[model samples]
Each structure stands twice: as structure tokens, then as C-alpha cells.
Target: MSIWKELYDIFDKERSRWQQSSASKQAIAFELKANLGFLADALSSGLSQSAIASGLECSIFEAKLKEGAALTALNRRKVTLTFIGEFSEFAKYVGKENDALVENAYSKIKSLQKLVAAEPNKSHDLRIKSLFRFLVFLVAHLEEQPLSRTSAKKAEG
Candidate 1:
């Protein structure tokens, strides 16, 4: 089966299990997957109102999932975001929307400018932090569609 198909299967199974479980945690997981799947389908079909609604639902579901995940992940080793580079690539890749990201970057740069003016010595850290924040925003934006298999191969290279 295609990777997307496999993922859909996995998500479907997990959602089913979650829905059946007595645990609120499982219910939350089910909701998260449902929203994610809806978002994926919507984006694939070209960002219709349904897709936007799904994305918004996913955002809400994520809040709950995050709380659960955080409790578990807190005990695990933390992976730094530095390896991923900037979130702009993610924004470009997933949401395929760049205008808002461009505006965000512009705003961030302006804020950094003010900071730099006040304390030139901290510019290095400020730049790094700004880059990290922008990248994270972009990454979250991109989590919607993902890349095509052929494009993924090119990206890996």
C-alpha cells in the first residue's frame, strides 16, 4: 500500500481504539487523529472550507493531545529543534502558504531590530532565538499536506 494509505490505516485503527477505550486520554487521541485526517483530506482536495474547519479542529484537538504527550515525553530524552533548520521550509512544504509566513518573518525581524538597537551584545542569541521561533511557526504551518514521494526523495538528496 502507499505510505499515505498505510498512515491512514494506522490512524484509523488508533482512532477506533481510542473511541472504544474508557480512558479520556484515548478519546483525546481519537479526536486528534480524526482532526488530522480531516485536515489531510481537505488539503489534498485543495483547501476548501471543510479543510479549514478540519485544520481548526485539529488545532483544538492538539491542545488536549499535547497535554497527554507532554506528560509522557517529559520523561523521554528531548530532541532539539536545531536539526530541522528553519520552519519556513515546513510552511512551504505542508500548508503551501507563504504569504503569512513572510509577513511573520518581517514582523520578527522588526522586533529583533529593536532588540538589537537596545543591546547589540545580545544580538547573537536574539538572532538564534528568532530563527528558532520562526522555524517552529513554519513547521507547524507545513504539517498539513506534507510532500509528494518524488519531492521527498529530492529533498532527502
Candidate 2:
């Protein structure tokens, strides 16, 4: 079977499982987090720099516009897949640029991936708020700055 088909089948099962019961809801939540963690790793490992940069753009937009309040585990599957589709398509148009911003964004996503595993007792709402703040900074900072990030700057003497 094709990768797309396989991914759809798996997510379909998860979505079906989502509707089954309250207990299953918790399982789906963890699954979404784990998926994001795996996604970060997979995207980091294999994709071209331009593609990853595109993904980062999509990630930042999704996080900021939705304001985290709208992004819950229930909708995470859709969000994740949409990101993959968008970035891959967007990559075909953009050129190699913003390597530093791409790397920085990748690091941030890695950090976000780790947050899910870090605090088991924390409420998802709190985690969402924290992630929202983190993403908000990216949108704010990136917009104000130019994309000429060739290298990380050293402290000025």
C-alpha cells in the first residue's frame, strides 16, 4: 500500500477510536503528542532544508492563528496531516533560504515535542497555553526581523 493510504488508514482507526469512550480519549491525546514528536524526528532526519523551512512556516501560522485554544488533541490528527501536505507543497515553490531561521524553528519544535513527555501531571490546557506563548514569540519575532539569518551572531564586544 502507498504511504498516504497507510497513514490515512491508521489515522482513521485513531479517529474511530476517538469516538468510542472517555478512556480512549486519553489514549488518543498521548498518541497525538507522540505523533508530533515522531514527526519532528522524521522531518528533521530526511527532508531538505527548504522543505523543513516551509514546514516551519506552516507550523508557526497554524499555532498562532488558532491561538492554541483551538488546537486540542481531538483536532491534532487533522492539524498534523495538514501540515505535512502544506509544507511539502510549499517546498516546491520556495528556494533554499533562511537556514538559520529553519534551524531555530526546528529546535523549537523539538522543544515542543519534548514538553508532552515532560509533565504527565500537567493539564493539557496549561500545556496548550505554554505552547501558545512559545509559538506567539516565533510569530512576533520573525515578523519584526529580516530573514537574512546566515549565521548565529556572537555577542558584540
Candidate 3:
């Protein structure tokens, strides 16, 4: 199956899971975070720097619109996905010690769902770009972790 189809399927399943129960929401958030992390690693390893840089430039251009109106009209789905990416990083940092962090991640994921649902007219390309941005943010967070502290914590654990 195409990547777009796969992503759509995952989104559908996650949305359904989100509606089932509180536990399901947690599960969906965890699954999405793991999937995005894996995608980030795969993209980082598979794609050339130039290709990634070009994509980043385009996203930056869209983000930097000087006109306040244009900026306000930015895709809500993308904004929500970015928030999900951020919450994922926070959850990773807090680990299992903080239920609130995980809950916040789930909440952001739900917000993304709502945005997508409300904006059914959004293009597939927009959704894919949002997902890519999320993965990039996640990868950056993973790479930002201090190795010394991480190792020390692991040893303590």
C-alpha cells in the first residue's frame, strides 16, 4: 500500500480507538508516538540531507508569512500535529513517572483528530507534510537528549 493510504488507515484506527475509552486514548497516543519516532529514524537514515533541507525550507517559508491574516489562516491540522510532536517529546522526557505528560500527549492527538475531522477539505499533501514535520520534531528531540545524563539515568534504573 502507498504511504498515504497507510497513514490514513492508521489515523482512522487511532480515531476509533480514541473514542472507545480512556485507556484506548493512551494506547493510541503511545502507538502514534512510537510510529512517528520510527518514521523519523527511517527518514533520517534513508533521505539525503539536501532533500530534507529543501522540505524544511518550504515548511519554514509557509510558517514565516509576514501577513498576520495569512498566518492566522494557517492549517489547524499542522498546528495540532506540531503540538502532538511537542507533547510526545515531553512524555519521553518524563517517561512513566508523569501520567500527566502522557495524558497531555493524548489530548494533543485528540485535538489533531478534531482538526482533521473539521477540515475534511484539507489536502492529503497537507496532512502528509504535517506528519513529516511531526517526525522531524520528534527526531530532533531524540537527538537532543544528553547522552551522559541518559546513560546515568539508565544505570540508576
Candidate 4:
């Protein structure tokens, strides 16, 4: 399937999982569209692979707060997939972009950390959850073959 189709599929799947009212779903969809736009813009900027990963991970945290306006658009509550499942998907994306994704993720995370530290107390739970979600997303997007499987094989020796 085309990338846009894949993204739409992901969005549809996630949207169906939500039990919220129609109004709420509409709001969520609106936010998601905005978020996707931001993601696209970021992708166009020629960010390093690490940068994309970093942005993906870091944006999760920002999605929760007003300060993370850039990322808040990406929020999709009632995410259907488990954290691990989300991570697995992200790992696939990371596999495609490797070094660039990692660098992107790292840089984005640093910026996110700064924002989180600035707020400290407000929306703490959401902030923490966002961070965890980002980590899961990163793990999912990263290449699966080389890192864990190879390491495990070596360890079994």
C-alpha cells in the first residue's frame, strides 16, 4: 500500500478503538491531521535519521501540553495498539531511516526534555506517559534484525 494509505489505515484503526463521542472523535481527528502535517514538515526539513526518531519520541511528550504545540497536534487518545505494538511499528520505520531516525529522535528528545523541565509539575502524568509512549514508538520504528536478535544470538554462545 501507499504510505498515505498506510497512515490512513493506522489512523482508522486507532480511531475505531476510541469509545468517545462523535464530537470527541472529530476533535481527535482534527488534532491528528494537524499532527501529521507537522510530522510531514519535519520530515521535509532534511533532519538526520536520528532526528526523525528523536522528533517522533520527543513529540509524544509534547502532545500532552500546550507548550508542545508543535507536537500536540499528533495526539490520538485511545490508541488501539499496546505500547509494544506501537513500538514494533515504529521499529519498522526506523529500519528504513536508521541513522537519520536515531539522530532526529535524539535531537527532538533533547528539545522535549527542555520543555518538560520548564513546566516541571503541571500535567506531570501526561508528560511522563508521553515520554514512555515515544520510547515505545522509537523501539517499534528501529530496525529489529541487527540489534536485539544479533545481541541475543551472541549472548547464547
Cα lDDT tens digits, model 4, 1-157, are 8999999999988787443333442443343334344555554575443343334433433343333222212232222233234235344443233234333444545655566556544443343344444443444333132234444458559
After superposition, candidate 1 runs with Cα above 4 Å error: 1-25, 54-77, 82-157
- Give the RMSD in angstroms, all C-alphas superposed, for model 3: 17.6
Tell how far residue 75 is off in model 1, in angstroms: 7.4
In model 4, the Cα lDDT at residue 78 comes to 21
- 1-157: candidate 3 lDDT, tens digit per residue: 9999999999999987545444433333345456455435546577442333232222222222222212212111222333334344333433322233323333444444455556645543444445555444433333343223345458559
Model 3 residue 125 lDDT score: 41
Against the true structure, candidate 3 reaches a TM-score of 0.27
Root-mean-square deviation of every model: 15.8, 18.4, 17.6, 15.5
lDDT of 1 by residue, 1-157 (tens): 8999999999999998655433543443344345445444544566543224323333323454454432221112222233233434443333323333433443454454465556555424535344444543433333423324454469459
List the candidate 3 regions with Cα displacement exceeding 4 Å: 1-33, 38-97, 122-157
- The lDDT per prediction is 0.42, 0.38, 0.41, 0.42
Distance from true location, Cα of 74 in model 4, Å: 27
Using lDDT as the yardstick, the better of models 2 and 4 is 4
User: Which residue pairs come into collision in candidate 2?
Assistant: none
Candidate 2 residue runs with Cα over 4 Å from true position: 1-102, 124-127, 144-157
